[model samples]
Target: MTRSELIAQIKQKKSFLCVGLDTDLTKIPEHLLDEEDPIFTFNKAIIEATSDLCVAYKPNIAFYECYGLKGWESLQRTATILPKDCFSIADAKRGDIGNTSKMYAKAFFDPQVSGFDFDSITIAPYMGKDSVTPFFEFKDKWAIVLALTSNEGSADFQNIENAEGVQLFEQVLEKVNSWGSIENTMYVVGATRGEAFLKIREHAPDHFLLVPGVGAQGGSLSDVCQYGMNKDCGLLVNSTRNIIYASKGTDFAEQARIEAQKLQKEMQIELEKAGIC
Candidate 1:
């Protein structure tokens, strides 16, 4: 999707919620195990139940890669059925040399080569520009670079102060923004880093942010919006276990919808408060 299209969806839905399809076979309803492709079956139901309430669906790649060939098949089927109105994210945190990065980008963005046609892909910035630039070559697709992650270990590298007294992540935000326009680039700013959003916005006021760690991770939604929200409501707050696994029974899809609705209502309120709705 183009930048304008994404902003339009946020306004139309009165939401910026991104539902994470970090589906685990063991965590899905037991009955689905008998299905030929249990992962895709579960994902289809969840997408059907909550597509109207969310603007994005991010399937963390590892969740599918772990199951080998069958896992990839499931990922393909799930991607094919994703709502056209919603953004599709291959949450594959890949980073490597130049040539290798091109293949990774093709895996998510080029449907002619890979079965999934994703709107964005998460990228680790450790390898610098070559690792990230390939994704930008794909028109209208996004490269969501990791900035301030929510994990405790993030402090080890991301928070380490540089010679200019700037944190490593801040430097990343500044440099990556130079490579592409806000239209094609975004940063992964974890919701757990509430006040950090303030720091991030100083560097990326117009760029969208793919925010995780909200619901199940105990990140405050109110705190995130207070500092991170831009005029376009440039934030996609993802909820994974909290919504998709709301119930492990046959009523799982219904429960997921309820959870998704709750987040959508909260997002609507935030959008109105920001005067974007």
Candidate 2:
């Protein structure tokens, strides 16, 4: 989706919520296991229940890759069923150089080749330019680069400063911005990094941010909006465990919708406060 299309959806829904489909077979309702494809079955239900409440859906790739072939099949089905109006993301934190990165791009952006086309993919910037630039080759697709992550170990590298005193994540935002326009590039800023959003905005005032680490991770939603929100409401705050795992019973989908509604209501208020609704 183009930046305008995305922004329109956020405004139309009065939300910037991105629901994470980090589906785990073991965690789903036992009754679903009886279905031919439990994962897709579960995802379809969640999508049907909450598609109107969210503007995006992110399927964490690792969750599917772990199951091998069957896992991939489930992912394909899930991708096929995703609402056309909602932005789709392959949360595949993939990074490689040259042809490898190109192939990764094709896998997610080229539906004819991989049967899984996503609006964007989470990319690790460790491999530098070559690793990330390949994704931008696909028109209208995005490269969501990892920056200040929520994980405790993120400080080990992302926080390291250079001789010029610029932190690694700061340098990443500066350099990556040069490779792509705000229309196609976004950074992964953890919601847990509340105050850090003040620093991040200094470098990327206009670029959209795909924020995770909210809900179950205990990141404050209000803090993220207060520090990170832009005029366009440039934020896609994701919630995984807290929504999807709200109930492990027959009412799982209903429970997921309730959880999503809660976030959507919060997001609507934020949009109103920012004068973007």
Candidate 3:
């Protein structure tokens, strides 16, 4: 989806919620195991239940990749079932040598190969521009580079001082923005690091931020928007465990919808406060 279309969705839904499909076969309802593909069966129901309450869906690739070929096939089927208007993301965190990165791009962006046709892919910037630019070449797709993550380990590298003492993530944001415009580029900012939102806004005031660390991670939605929002409501606040895994029973999907609705209702209030609706 384009920037305008995303913003329009945020406006239309009165939400900036992004639901994470971190589906784990081990945790789904026992009854679903009787289905041909339990993971896809669970995902389809969850998407049907909560698609209207969210503006995007992010399927973290690790959950599926860990299960091997069956896991991959499940991901393909899940992606096919997502609502068309909701922006889809493959939180693959992929970046490698230029040639390998090209293949990764083809894997995710080439609708023929993966059947994902995701609007965005999370990419690590440690390897620098050559590893990132290949993904940017795809038309209307996005390269969401990692910036300040929400994990405690983020302090280990992302906050390290440079020669001038500027944090590493700050430099990453500034340098990466030169590689692509705000229209096609975005940064991943963890919600747990809400304090850094103001600093990030100072660096890329108009760019969209794919925010994780909410819900189960304990990041406050209100705090993130207080400092991170632009006039366009440039934030996609994501929740994973707290929503999709809300219940491990046959009513799991209905339970997921309840969790999503709670977040969307909260988001609607935030949007109203920001005059975004």
Candidate 4:
């Protein structure tokens, strides 16, 4: 979706919640195993339950890639059914050589070639511009580069300071923002690093941020909004296991809805406070 469309959805839903489909076969409801495609079945139900409460859905590719062909089919089904107005992201975290990056872009953005269409793809910027630019070639698609991740290992590289006294992630923000605009580029700013949001905003005042690690990871919603929110409500806070795996029983979907509703309500209040709604 385009930038205006995404902002419109955030206003219409009074939310910026991004539901993560980090579906694990072993962790899903036992009863769903009887279905032809348990993962898709679970995802369909989850989408049906939380569609109105969220503005986006992100499916981590590894979850299905490990399952192979059957898993791919399930992802295909999930992608096909995703609500058009709700942004869809392939949380693949892919970036390679220039030519290869183009293929990756086609895989996620071109449904005819890859059997699924994603509004955006997560990218690792370790290889620099050529590795990341291919994804931006597509209209209305986005390249969400990794900035400050939620993982502990990120401290090893992302926090390393340069000779200029700027940290690696800060440099990344400046460089990546130069390649794309606020319209098609976004950064992955982990909610767990709430304190970093202020610094992040200084560099990316207008760009949208796709934040993870809120639910199940102990990140505070209030803390994230306080620092990360922009005039357009430029944040897509994602919750994975805490919502999708809310229960491993027949009541799973209902439980997921409850979790999503809780977040949406909190988001609505934040939007109101920021005068964004």
lDDT score for residue 130 of model 3 = 89
Query: What are the TM-scores, per candidate, against the unseen true structure?
Result: 0.99, 0.99, 0.98, 0.99
Q: Report clashes for each candidate as comma-separated counts.
A: 0, 0, 0, 0
Candidate 1 C-alpha lDDT tens digits along 1-277: 9889999999999989999999998899999999988899999999999999999999999999999998888898898899999998899999899999999999899989986689999999999988889999999999999999988888999999978899999999999999989999999999986898999999999999999999788799999999999999999999999999999999999999999999999999999999999
lDDT of 3 by residue, 22-93 (tens): 888888889999999988988899899999999999999999999899999999998888788999899999
Candidate 4 segments exceeding 4 Å error: none
Candidate 1 global lDDT = 0.94
lDDT of 4 by residue, 16-123 (tens): 999999899899999999999999999999999999999999999999999999989999999999999899999999999999999999999997888778999999
The candidate, 1 or 2, that scores higher on lDDT is 2
Candidate 4: Cα lDDT at 272: 100
Model 3 ranges with Cα > 4 A deviation? none
Ten-residue region with minimum lDDT total, candidate 4: 108-117
lDDT of each: 0.94, 0.94, 0.91, 0.95
User: Model 1 — TM-score against the truth?
Assistant: 0.99
10 residues in a row with least lDDT, candidate 2: 110-119
Candidate 1 residue 91 C-alpha distance from true site, Å: 0.1
> RMSD, model 1, all Cα superposed?
0.7
> What does the lDDT read for residue 78 in candidate 1?
90
